[model samples]
Target: MSDEGHWFYCLKHMRVEYGPGCPNKDRMGPYDTEDRAKHALEHARERNEAWDAEDADQGS
Candidate 1:
């Protein structure tokens, strides 16, 4: 469960990186693949939609 060799999407620069390029708070990470990191925004939106649907299903 370590962060070594992981990829990250830097929100500040809007790019993907594989090392300690930006602050953790300003990036989304630990993605196993660079492709996933590259589509971070899309992945986030997909997760958000799934959560929103679940919330609607729960009536909350």
Candidate 2:
């Protein structure tokens, strides 16, 4: 996606940034909205939990 209107969660600054704030390695995403970018850590945790559950289910 284009980086013009996207938002990102800046890991280094711990804040929501609008359009190309920090380097990609120190940020969460090009989320469509600022609110989504703000919740990046929560989203990541939820996804990780879901993936872990899926892995466990597959193993079982």
Best by lDDT: 2
Score each candidate by Cα lDDT.
0.90, 0.91
In terms of lDDT, the poorest run of 10 residues in model 2 is 19-28
lDDT of 2 by residue, 1-60 (tens): 666899999999999999866788999898989899999999999999999999999999
lDDT of 1 by residue, 1-60 (tens): 455789999999999989767889999987989999999999899999999999999995
Residue-pair clashes, model 2: 0
Error of 1 at 56 (Å): 0.9
Question: Model 1: how far is 60 from its true place, Å?
Answer: 7.9
True-structure RMSD, every candidate:
1.9, 1.1
Residue pairs with colliding backbones in model 1 are none
Q: How many Å off is the CA of 9 in candidate 2?
A: 0.3
In candidate 1 the C-alpha lDDT for residue 6 amounts to 93
